[model samples]
Structures are given as structure tokens and as C-alpha cells.
Target chain A: MRSKTRRAALAVLSAGTLLLAAACGGDDSSEADESTITWWHNSNNEPGKGYYEQVAKDFEADHPGVDVQVSAMAHEDMVDKLAAAFQSGDLPDVYMERGGGELADHVEAGLVRDLSDDAADEVEKIGGSVAGWQVDDKTYALPFSLGVVGFWYNKEQFEQAGITELPITMDDLYDVIDKLKAADLTPLSVGAGDKWPAAHYWYAAALRSCPEEVLTDAVGSLDFSDDCFERAGDVVEELIETEPFNAGFLSTPAQEGATSASGLLATGKVAMEMQGHWEPGVMQGLTDDGKGLGDKTGWFPFPEVDGGEGDPAAQLGGGDAWAVPEGSPDVAVDLVRYLLSDEVQTGFAENDMGLPTNPAATGAVSDPALAQLLEVRDAAPFVQLYFDTAFGESVGGAMNDEIALMFAGKASPDDVVSATQQAADEEK
Target chain B: MTRGGWRQRLEILLFVTPALALLGVFVVWPIASAVRMSFYRWKGFGPMEDFVGLRNYDRVLGDDVFRDAVAHNVVIVVASIVVQLPLGLAIAMLLNRKIRLRGLLRTIVFVPYVMAEVIAGVIWFQLLQPRYGVVDGIISAVGLTPPEQGFLGTPELALPTLFVVLTWKYLGLAVLLFLAGLQGVPDELYEAAQLDGAGWWQTQVRVALPLLGPTIRTWLFLSMIGSLQQFDMVWVLTGGGPANATTTMATYLINQGTQRHNYGIAGAASVVLFLVSFVMALAYQLLILRRDTVTQE
Candidate 1:
């Protein structure tokens, strides 16, 4: 019995030693020759994904000693992974960035490598593009694509409804919706199934009245208040009262809403949709002809409400960006230089992802709609980043929840104000 | 100098050490860290921690969303007791029968319990999606609109919808437990009752169900505990949305703790949840266990 005990103790000690050795082993990061740089991406779509993967491969080939291994994730999936990665302090060297100060969370946590000097140098080539990536005096992410949501109405349906032009004011738009409904058509296509899309109504309303500085501050502070939030609920209520949505929008899940929105708009069952430039891509997904709902389906900026600071030109939109994590071994300067090179920028434009950050990317893009969007980008005096990225997640929670409430009609515009105020108070 | 006595003590020490080590590593260590971290204000990322004691707790209670979340959890418990338990019991009784295709029916009934929460949520989400949903289409065909209003979209329906989802998701587990209890009941006792001129209902009430008291108690405890910890489905569906209607304790804790980067507040909420649930579980065990002992005596 004593002998058996000794043997058992010895066996346990041996296993412990093996585990300790393995755990204490060096990572061997100093190995000479080729370096592997991990790149995390969230691009899951076809050409958009293909365009990026090809660029990464091309970049790897150009730099013989650097292997850029790219991994893809879905949009929200990336946020969770990024959060876990940040907690573990093992962020990838490079990763996909959703624009605005979305990186602020990481930056505040000291997880990001500031590319201020690199951004300053690249700005000359990129031109007056300080919209998406800048934080204070520095840059942490670079602009990849530009997106703006407005009215994408079926021209045929509008014409059939005896409307000569798209509406340009709240009154005119609401009237148009009524007219469309009178014609037995769904007035507007809105997907509330993905609550975010449903929730956009509040942000759209808040953007109208919330001064740019205050809006930016509120976003930074995550100070949700009833004051700035009141208009969103009012606008949503007004919109809903017009019966602009399809017969069963509330019951529709987000995906089905996507399908229904596309189908109704394409088949001219709906006069218009509140969407961005990606409507064409969405349209293409739904139809074989790819001409979409009508040959004349065109976009108009969200019309101004009564007594609002935001003009037709003041837009709420954001895009993608790229950033290098602090742990990345590659020099930030070289990476930015290669990434923003005229050749790469040209490839980016050619893919029609969005208006390029590089000013030299002009004429590389040929899509008329995208080119029009670029014109909008240039003319805009203010470009709003998404609110989700503007505030840290907790305070941002207030905005998301309140916005959802306003959409569901449980809360009025006044309620949005109270909700935001409550959230702000709690945050403080 | 008894050699056997020393050997026996040595053997007991050896056996206990591995278990003690595992408990220390897996259970105690994490709990200790969570308790320690609860006193500090830090996003899960930053190295900086501002030591703030009960402040996180203060903030948690102050937040209306958190308050609403606690209320929602209470509602869920009430729902499980009122609806989930009874339904599960009925299903279990049916399964206990020597009916044809019993095995097939049991497998079919039990399948949903094993499904991953996210997968089940997705399937339900798909089934409920308004615009192009199959169920929506069927409802339309039947001249009955499912709702132009999104069931999950409206604030009124979000919590109720979540409750329905939870019921569907958890009923299978409840049924399984009740079935196990029903099997342990002595058939001879029922036969004796039958010989004594008792009906099936009387036999069940006077003998089977009475004997099943322990099993039922055990199951109710487990079901209630499980319901209180519910998070995944709520998070996936409304994200505690339509104005914080569906926010439960666990979901709120995570949002406050992980998403908002307020580990301190989340920890406070967790501590509260942990204490509340722990006490309930303990009280339940004590009551049932005492009753069980008395019955045995």
C-alpha cells in the first residue's frame, strides 16, 4: 500500500512537471526570417469580401517577408471577438474597422496604435477627408467606404401615383406616402425586423435638431436625453401615422423585411424605401434584371423637418476603415503607405465599395450612383458617424433601447428625451 | 502500531487532495476574482481600476432598466410555475403511458431540449419574421394577418413573445424530469389500489402523485433556478428591446458589465442575483429535504 502511494505521487509529479514546462515555454516571437501578421476582417459579402481578400494577398506578395493572414467575421460577430481579444490583450496586428470613433473604446483601453503622423502625411494624397477616422488631433482608423441613408423611391410607382417629383420636405413626403397608399401601394418600405434599421428613425430625427457640436458631444458622452431625442419619436409617429410601411411590417423579422422591402420596391408595390447606396446591391440580390424596381429609381436626401438645423446637405452616414493594433509588428507608417498607395486606392474605387479616402482614386470608379454619392460626400458640411460607435457601449445602450421604444410606438418623441436623460443621469 | 489505520488515513488524504485542488482551481478561484473585481471600476480591458465599493451596486439599483430587468425575472419565475410546470407534468404523464410509438414520441418531444439556444432562437426568429416568413405567409393565406405589427417589434409583445419562446425551449427539460419521477413510482402500489377499487385518477392522486412528491419538488427547484438565469434568447431576440421590456437579470448584468465596460456595476448586479438565487435554492432544498426525511421516517 505504501509502495502504491509513492508510485501515485510520482506519477502526479511527472504530469505537473510536463504541464509546467509547456505553460512556461517561450513564444519564440523573435524567430528570424518571415513574419506572420494576423489581420482580422468582418467583410462577409461577395465582391466586397473578394476585393479585400485579393488586396491582402497582393500586399503579402509585394512584401516577401511579411505574411498577412486574414480572418473574416460577421459585423456584430467581430465586435464580440474584438472585445474578447481586447480583454485577453492579444489583439491581431491589423483588423477591419467600422468607421467613426468606434475604435474609441479600444483607444481608451490603450489597445489601438495611433496613426496620427501617418494620417497627416496621407491626408495630402487623400484630400480633405477627415470625416471617418480622426479622433482629436490623431487618426486611428482610415476611411474605407461611405454610406448615406435616404429615400430610394420607385420612380414608376411615383409616376403612376401622379407625383412628378420626390418629396423634399416632411409635409411633402408624408403627403406622397398618403398618395401612394391611396393608389393601393405600400407607401414606403422600412425593415423594422432588424431593430437597428427600425431604430434608425430616432437617430434620423435627433440629427435634425441636435446641433452638430451637441450631437457630437452627446454621442461622446452617451448622454441620452429627452430634449434632443424628442424629435425622433415625433417623426417616427408622424411617419407611422401615414401608413408608409407595408401591410405587415411589424410582424416581419429583419431578414424577411429585407426580402419584402426589396420585393415590394422592385415590383412597384411600394413607392419608396428608406435606404442607402447599397439599395442597388440589395436590388440585385432580389431581381435577375438588376434594373431594380424601376429604371428611374433614384435617391433623395432625407427631407428637412420644421425648424431643424440640418440642411439637405447635412447627412448622417459613416463607413468602414482600417487600423493596426498596437501589438502589430509591422511599422504603422509602411502599412498606411502601402494601404493608401494610388494603386491600392484605385483598386478600392474600382470595386465600387464606396467613395475612396484617397483623392487620387477619382476616375477609377465608374458607377454613376456611387459617383453621385461621392459628389454628396464632397458637398456635405457635416458627416455624422453612427451613434453606436460614438459612445461607449453602456451609454450607447440607452440610445439603442430608447430608439427601439420610439419605433415600436411605446415611447413618443418626448419619451426619447426622458429616456436619454435618464441614461445620461445613470451614466454620470 | 496498527499499519492499517495509518494507511487508511493516507488513502483518504490522497483521494481528497485531487478534488480539493480541482475545486480550488475551477470554482473558488473564479468566484474569488469576481468578488474582488466587483469592488473596482474598470472596463474589462483597461489596466486601471478605480476602487469604488458599493457604488456599483448603487448605480445598478438606480438604473431603471436594471429595476425593470429584476421585475422581468420575477415575471418569468411566475410564468414557469403557473404554466411551464403544469404543461411539463402533463407531457411527462403522457410519456409514462404504454402508448404506441412512445419511443418516437419521446425522442421528438425531447429533441428541442438539446438544441442550442442560438439555433433555436434563429429558427423561431425565421418562423416569426414578418415580411417573408413562412408562418406569416400562411397566416396571410388564411385571411388572418399574423400582425402588420412585428410581434417582437412592439413593446407590448416583446416580453410575452420571449416568455413563449422560453416556455417552448424549456418544456422539454421539465417533461424529462417529470417522466423520471413517474417511472420510479411503484406499479404494485397502483395495482394494489386498483384491487381495492380505486379509479385511475384516484390511484394517481392517492398513490402515484403522492409518491412523486420528491421528484416534483426537485424538478420545480431546478426549473425555477434555470428560468432565473435566462439570458441568451432575450439577447438574441429583442436585445432587451422595445424599451427594455424583455431585459432580464443576466442580460442586464452582461450589458452593464461587459458591453458598457462597467465591470463594477455588472459585478454588483451579479452579486445581487447570485445572493437572491442562492438563498431561494437553499430554502427550497431545506423545505423539500425536510419533507423527504419526514416521509422516510
Candidate 2:
């Protein structure tokens, strides 16, 4: 009996020792690869994934002994993994950063490496596009793709509705909605179920109503006291009253499958959907033949509001940037700079992956509708980052919830502003 | 101590250590950390330095959304027992009879409970979609007008619709439990009731139900707890949306924690959920379940 006890104790001790040794072994192996630079990206599908792999290989060939280990993940999976990484303080050497308040949070925690000095040339080339990834005038990430949000419409449907010209003003937009309804078509589809898609309308409205300075200052101050902010909500309210959205728009998802807002537009159940540059790609995935709206796709900016103080040409948008985590090797910055290089970005544009930020790549956009979008994006005075990204999740979430409530005819326009102010106050 | 006693002690310690260690690491540690987190203004990451005592709790309690979530949970809890008890009892009693193809009938009834929650949620989401969904088609086919925004899209109908879906998902468990309880009743009791010239209804009401008290109480406890922690179905279906009409406490906490990055608020909300569940469970065990324990002893 005593021998049995001793045997059991010996087994336990050995197991503990084995586990400790294995843990130590893992630590040693990870430390052994000093030249390894881990990169995580969300281009898990096709040409984009293959392109990134080639880019990594090219970098490796150029700089011998420096290995770039790329992990291509689906967008949401990458975001979730990055969040976990942030909490653990064990992030990949390089990863995609969505910029704005999310980047600010990472910067505040000292998790992101400052690229102001390291990638200065590339930052300079990227120019104003770097504004979203900047903190206290120091750049932390290099934006490779910066695209504006606009109304992606179906040209065939527009023609069928006898809409000869794209809507350039809020009144014109309402007229278009009326015309579409007369044609017995759902005029628009907003994914209010996801909240952010619905909130984008208000963001676009605010961009049209508020002056650029006030809008920029609000990002810094978290203030929404300006009457224009409430006016923006009023714009959304007026639009909501027009009843242009698809049936059950309040419960529709953003981009999921064929039943989503983008899906409705993709499947031609709705005439248009206000979405980012990724709309075409998203639509393609939702269709049977994967042609999406194909050649019938059209692009137009969110229309100017009546009596608004802001520039009509200023667009609402946000994009991803390449950021190196704090403590990453200097080589990681070099890799990020290379990613933003003209050659690489142009190649990115050629693939029709995104709206490349580099000027040289602007002409390389292959898709006709994307090319049109690029023209409007370049002509715009400035692209306002999505308010949700600019304000961080807490305030943005509150703002979105209130806006969603407004869509449900529960919250008033004033309530939207107050709820947002309340949340922003909490942040302060 | 005798050598045999010492060996026995070592044997017990060796066998119990892994489970206790697991319990400490996974369960006790998370609860402790969540409690600690509830006292701070943490945004899911960085240092946990901003210690705001009870502020998160205050915010959670004050938020109308959280209040609505709690109310939804309560409605689900009470409604589950109220609706499922008699319905489950009836189904169980019917299935308990020596009906033809009993095994196939039982499997069909139990199928939903056996299926994955997410898969069921996805299938139901598709079926409940507005204008074009199978549910809408069926309703329209029956010459009834479905709500313009469909069942899950309308705020007034969303919660009720969710409740119906949940009932469909969980009714099998209740029926299966009741059936098991009925099986445990002595055959002689029914025979004796027959000798007394009791009708079928009288036998079931007098002899079967009384004997099934423990199982019924146990099933009620399970249903109540399950309803309180309901998240997956609500998340997949409405995402507590159509203006936060269907928000449960679990969904609310997830929205606060993951979606909003307000870990402190999430932690506070979770602690409140834990407390509510704990108190209710304790009260039930002490006041209601104690009878069964006493009888067994």
C-alpha cells in the first residue's frame, strides 16, 4: 500500500517536471528565432492572400536572414485574435490596424511602435491618409488603402426607374427614393441590425451639415454640442420618414449572406446600398455566379445636405493600415514601409483588392466602378473617418444604439445627440 | 495514523488534486478576476489601474438597456415554467403510452435538444426572415398577414417570437425528463389505481403526478436557469435588437464587454447576473428542493 502511494507521488512529480520542461522548451524555441517577423493580415481569400505571400517572399529575398511569417486570417477572426493579443501583450510583430480611436487606445497603452521616424518617406507619400493613424502628430501606422464610403447603386435599376442622373443633394436623393418607390422597388437597404451600417447615414449627414473643423475637433474633444450635430440626426430622421429602406431593414445584417443589406443590393432586391469600397467584393461573394451586380454596378457619393456648412465634396470613409507592435524588430518597420511602397501598392490596386493610398497606384485600379470611386475619393477635400471608429466603441456604440432606436421610431433626433453626449461624457 | 490510513490519505489526495486544480484554474480564478475587474474602469486591455469602486455596478443598474435585459430574463424564466410544465407533462404522458413506433416518436421529439444550438439558431434565422422566409410564406399561405417587418424585426413581436423559438428548442428536454419520471413510477401503483376504478385521467393525476414531483421540480430548476443564461439564440436571431427589445442579461453583458470594449461594465453586469442566479438557485434549493433531499435522506 505504501509502495502504491510512493508510485503515485512519483508519477505526479514526473508529470509536473515534464510539463515544466515542455513550457521552457516552447519559450526557448520562440526566442531562438530573432530574425522572425510575424505578420497577420485579413486577406485570407484569393489573389490578395497570394499577393501578400509573394510580397513576404520578395522581402525575404531582399533582406536575407530576416524571415517574414505571414498569417492570413478572415477579417473578423483577425480582429478577435488581435484583441486577445492586445490583452495578453503578446501580439504579432506586424498586423493590420483599423486606425482612429482603436489605434489611439493601442498607442496609449504603448502597444504600437511609433513609425514616424522609421517609415517617414512612406508616411510622407501616404500624406493626409495617415491622419487616421496619427496620435499627437506622431504617425504609428502606414495606411496602404484609404477608400471613401459612397452609395453603391445598380445602374440597370436606376435606368429602369428613369433616374437619368445621380442624386447630388438631399432633396434629389428623396426624389430618387420617390421615383424608385413609384417603380415598385425598394430604394435602399441599411443593415440597422448591425447598427453601424445604419449609423453611417448619420455620419454622412453630419459630414454634410457640420464644418470640417468642428467635425475634426469633435474627434479630439468628444463634443457634440454644435447644433449641426443635431441637424445631422434631423437629416437621418427626415430620410427615415421617406421609408426608402428594404423591408425589415431594422433586422437586416450588414454583409452576411444573400439576405443582408449588401446582399439585397447585390441580388437587385434593392436599388442601392451605402457601403465602403469593399462593396463590390462583398456583393460578388453573395451572388450565385459570383458576378455580383457585375458591370451594372454604379458609384455615387452621399449627397449634400440643404443649408449645410460643410464641403459637399468631403466624403465619409475609413480604411486599414499596417502597424508594427511595440518591441517589434526595426525590420518590421522596413516591411511596413515596403508594403506602402509605390510598386507594392500599385500591385495591390491592380488586383482590385482596395483603393490604394499611393498616388502612383491610383491609376492602377482595374475595376471601372472602383476607378470611379477612386476619382471621387481623390477629388474630395477630405475623407472623414467613420464616426464609430473615430469615437471608439463605447461612445460609438451608444450613438449607434440611439440611431437604431430612431430607425425603429422609438428615439427622437434630440435623444440621439443626448445619448451620444452622455456616453462621451462617461469617456471624459 | 496507521500506515494503511496514511496510504489511503495519499490515495485520496492523488485522485482529487487534478479535479480541484482544474476547478481552481478555470472556475474559481475567473470568478475572482471578474470580481476584481468589476471594481475598475478597464477597457478590456492595458493595465487594470483605474479602480472605480461600484461605479461600474452603478452604471449597469442605471442603464435602461440593462434593466430591460433583466426584465426579459425574468419574463423568459417565468414563462418557460408556466408554458412548458403542462405542455411538457401532456406530451410526456402521451409518449409514455405503448403507442406504435414509440422509439421513432421519442427520437423525433428529442431531435431538437440533440441538435447544436448554433445550427438550430441559423436554420431558424433563415426560416424567420421577413418577406421571403419559410415562416412568412407559411403564414401568408394560411391567409394571415405576417407583420410587415416579419416576426423578429418588429420590436413588439421580437421578444415573443424569441420566446416561441426558445420553447420549440427546449420543450423536448422537459418532455424527456417528465417521461423519465413517469417511467420511474411503480407499475403496481397504476394497477392498484385501476382496481380502485379510477379513470385514466384520475390515475395520472392522483398516482403519477404526485410521484413525479421531484422530477418536475428538478426540470423547473433546469429550465429557469437555462432561460436566465440564454445568449446564443438571442444573439444569432435578433442580436438583442429591433431596438434592444429582446436583450437578455447574458446578451447585454456580451454587448457591453466585447462589442463596446467596456470590460468593467461587463464585469459588473456579469457579477449581477451571477448574484441573481445564485440567490434564486439557493432559495430554490433551500425552500423547494430541500423537501426532495429530506425525503431521500
Candidate 3:
């Protein structure tokens, strides 16, 4: 009986091993159907969510027998799931890509489909905004909504602080800070804990201090030896010395809750915060009544620095794009092109989802604050993608960490440049 | 060979095979893969073709942030034992007495341990927020000033503040273990000590304490290991921020691996962590826990 029991156990053990092997070895894409297209997006909240559902239905109706499976998730959740999918080589038919070195990496790995030929007409209509998603002149993704980062301030707080005209230069900015401080108001609140928000100060400074060519060259080379880069750090350091930030700003989160930097601006606790075009929407979410700063919401571009080599009109920004995975069916590219069409983009603008990339939809932005931002975005000589995004996560993460250290009064401006350079050197 | 002997051997093999198979698949395989990963400079998703030998290890040891993280882990391990040992012992001793509402007191002492780590972390995070937090409000209410950047936001205070939170979360375990140890002592021994006119404090120190040696030593070992591997509280409370002041090795590896995509560096850091833990646990088992096992044997 014992011998029989041992034999049975052996059979079970072999069977389990075989099952495990089968589970691990299965390829998700091997049995994929041509008629089925999977699209994952992060517009999981209202009007945006409902609008996207309608868009998917319209596409399916146009091409009968083709099934488009739509999965809308929270932004962070979608990012995490996409990362997992990338690692497993089992990506959906189409997904959002925040272009820069991340897209470049995806392209190099042969994970993204090049749309230069397939979506040529749509690409032509989108124009320069698609530059961020292109690797070596081959466009891998189609930008939908491109926007710039700038100071979003409370108009009431600005008025209360006795600021008359918007600051046009670094000295003017300093004067404004002094005036706000005199009024017992926090001049600025940055989410240094998130690191990227603190790093945005440096990115904007770099945009002002470096010549456009030098900035563009540095992106390709990952070299920060230029004097302008150090100058950018110096500008940030001078700003830090003013001590104009909110108390406990070093550990403040970005957009999580009411206590975050955007929250402080939304609730009128601070006069200003440097943030993306999504600030108004983020603020709306953080407020109880869902009308963030209401009529008090105001926007302004980053002030130019003294003796800066960059164009006074240059801005720092980035945007998300729709990218088809390399193995996706041909219809997936058609869906991406359709998504970027003027009609869909106009609807996207009407919903105030983002700053639309399609010029045809630019006039449709209903939010007055967003409309002003769209004008600034169009008027800028060029929008430099946020340096962290341009440099990719590893180097970008190190740079952000050092910048955050500087915010805590730990690292010097020189330390920031060297740390970033070291991380970039490793990437070589 | 005898048929009965063959059957007996088969019976033993039948029970052990399943367990060995599980250990090989889950534990051994993951460890081996991690060790292999340390030798490559691959991104998280790509082919592991960039073999860099010991360079990743070299970088991990050379990075100042990583070194600081190691130091933080050490500090946590030492502090958890130093701070929690006496505090837990005192509470356990007091609760062991025939005092009023002893059951209620015991339940209260052990409550924090039953709470999830993440939930407790979130609660402490809110309570310690800068100016608006309950702790800061109380400090202001009492007319004493709190730190300008909050407890978890100040570079010098983040680690110490984390230690206090950790002690609150974990002291319950130490108390529970010590109380159980106290219960095991014979009633006859206490009675004899009482007949000898021993005071309560004296009885505890001279008689009960000596017999509670194994339990105290065991608790220290557990606490040390837990503190060395601490992550969740630190992750939620401060995220090793305010200039990376409270980073532990676990956080360091996670930041490198997931946040920065430096998979090789993370793998090397993980290997170093495993070696450190292995040596510590082995030394402890041989140098300390061996006594308990030897006495039992």
C-alpha cells in the first residue's frame, strides 16, 4: 500500500510540473485574432470616459465584424499595467505613450509600430507636435494633446498680495515674491516629494538659460557640460534662496489630495504653483464643490532669466500619444489615425480633456484658462519636452533626486549637474 | 533487498518529494535567477545580454545613496531592539499582574500588531503631517513649537520619527511574546519566592527574568530581522525623502529596479541584501539560538 501511495504521488508531482510549464510557456499573442483590436486608455472619468466609449462604437460601426475591446483604467493603473505588458511582450493593440526617451526606448526594442508611412496624411495634419514621438525621423506614435507647463496662480491671492502686472523677468518675479511675502502669503508651493515637480523648476530654468540649439543637442548627446546648464541650476538656486515656497514643501506630494501642491493653489492657500495644462482638471478633482479656483484661476508663462541665451518665448512641455504595438493588426493604425482626426480631437477639446494637438480643434477649447494656454503653446518658438522625460527614467530619476536634494538645502547647483551627468554617462 | 524495507523507503520518499519539488520551484529558482540577473546590465524588459560581471555590484556599493540606505537599515535594527526591549518588557510584566481589567489592558497592548502595516502607516502619515496634523496641532496647543517642515519632512528627524512609529506598530508583538513566556513560569516557583519574602520587583528580576532568557533572545532575533527588512512604513511615511534621509536597503533596491529601471543594479543590491541577511541569520542561529535548541535536545 505504501508503495502504491508513493507511485501515485510521483504521478501527481510530474503532472503538476507539466502544468506549471504549460502555464509559463503559453504565448499571449500566438492565438490573437485579426478581427479583434484591444485599446487601453486612461480617460476613466466622466465626459472623457463616455466620449471615448462613443468614439470606439463609431469606429466599430464603420468597420463591421471588427471587434475593438476598450479598457479604460485610472492613469496610474494603466501605466503600471502597460509596464508589465511591455516586460511580458504581450501588449494591447494600441495604448498611450508619453513620448521622449521612453518612446525612443520602445522603438529601439521593436515594440512600437512606425506610423510614418501608414498614417502619413494624419501625420502631416498633426505637424510639429508629433516630433516628440518620432525616433530618427520615423514617427512611432501620434500625439493627441500637446501642452506646456507654466505657473498656475490664484488671481484673488495675486490681487491680495498687491501684484499689479504679471512678472516678465527674473527680477520682476523676485519683486512679486517679496510683495507676496510682505502680504504674509506663501508665494509658491512645489511638490518636491514627487521629485518631478521640483525638477520642473530646473527644466524651465534650462529652457530659459540655454540656446535652442544647445538644448536640442544636449538631448541627443546626454551631455550637460554647457555653461547654460550650470546657469539654469544657478537660477534655481537664487529662487530657492528667496525662501518663497510653502512651509513643509519639501515633502509635499504633487496632485494626490487637498494637502498637495496643486491642492494648496486650488484651495487658495498659496498664490502660485508651477504645473502642466492639466492643473485645472486636477484642481477640480481635489476640491469638494468640483469648481477648483473657480473665477480665481489664472495662468502665466515662466519668466525669462537675465542674460539668458534661449528665446524668451520658449516653453517646457510634453504630451501623451496613441501608439500601436508592433504586432497589432492594420486596423489598429486606422483607429489611431481616426482618434487623431479633427472631428474626434474637436470633441476631445469640447470635453476639456486636454490641450488638443489638431489645429482644427484648437478653437474649440471652452475653458478660458486652457484657451490662453493653447495660445501660448502655439506662439512659443518651440516647446522643449520636460528634460526628465527626454532623458528617460534612469537618468531623469537621478536628476530629479538631486534637484529634490537641492530643494532641501542639501545639494548645491554644481552637485545637480554632476549627478545628472554621471547617470547619463552610465546610459552610454 | 527485503520487500518490506523497499516499501518503507518508498513511503518516506512519497512524503518528501512534494515538499522538495515546491522548494526547488519557488525558493531556489527565484534566488538563482536573481543571482544570474546581477551579472547583466539589461533593462527590466529586454534580453539579458549585456553581461557586466561584478560591475553592477561595484556600482551598488559605490553609490552614496545605497551606502546611506545600508546605514539606515543598521540603525533601525539596533534601535528596534534597544527601544522596544525594555518598553515591551515593562508593559508585559505589568499586565501579568492580578490587576483590574487585565484582559482589557492586554487586548489594548496587542491591538496595533493585529492592524495591517499599510493602514497603520497611512494613519501615522496623516497624524504627523506638518502644520495641520494632529501631533503638530497638539504641540501648538500645548504652546510648544513643532518642526518647521513637519516631523517626516525634516532631514534630521525623518528617521527618528519613523523609529517612533515603528515602535508603536511592533511593540505589541514583543509584549505578546513576553507575556506568553511569563505565563509558562510555574506557580510553585512564585509561591516559593513569596514565602521567602521576595518583593514583586525582586521576584520578577531574580526569578522570572532568568527563566525568560530564551524568549527574550528569540524576540530580539525576530525584531532585528523585521527592522532590517523594513519598507512599507518608510515608503508611505516619507518615501525616503527630505534628502533620502530614511532609506533602507529594501527601498533602495525597489527605487533602482522599478522607478529608475536599473534592473542590474537592483539585482546586485538584492544579492548583497540576501548575503547580509543570510550571514546575520546564520550567525544568530549558531551563536544565539543554538543554546535554546541544545538545551531542548
Candidate 2 local Cα displacement, residue B60, angstroms = 0.6
Candidates' DockQ values?
0.43, 0.68, 0.67
Q: Give per-residue lDDT, candidate 1, residue A259.
A: 46
lDDT of 1 at B60: 81
Q: Largest DockQ belongs to which candidate?
A: 2
Predicted complex 2: DockQ: 0.68
* Highest-TM-score candidate: 2
The segments of candidate 1 whose C-alpha lies over 4 angstroms from its true place after superposition are A1-36, A44-64, A99-101, A154-162, A189-194, A210-233, A246-271, A276-297, A327-330, A425-428, B1-26, B131-150, B293-297
- Per residue, candidate 1 scores C-alpha lDDT tens digits across B127-148 of 7666566767788898985755
TM-score of chain A of each: 0.84, 0.95, 0.96
CA shift of B89, model 3, Å? 0.8
Tens digits of per-residue lDDT for model 1, A1-428 = 76988899777656655655664554454232237777677767767688778877787777777776777878778978877776667667776676554477677667777777656677556544555566665788666566676777777777878888667788988888778777877787666544556666666766786677778677556554535456656777787776678754543333332346666676665777776667766676566675665456777877877777655577767677778776566543365567777877788788776677777786788777677777777677777766655554555556666666656666666766766566557555
lDDT of 3 by residue, A1-428 (tens): 75777578879779778857874884656456889999999999999999999999999999998899999999989988988888888888989999888888888888899999999998999888888888899999999988999999999988998899999999999999999999989999999988899999999999999999998888889999998989998999999999988878888899878888999999988999999999999999999999999899999999999889999898899999999988788999999999999899999999999999999999999999999999999998898999888889999999999999999999988999999999999999
Best-to-worst DockQ order: 2, 3, 1
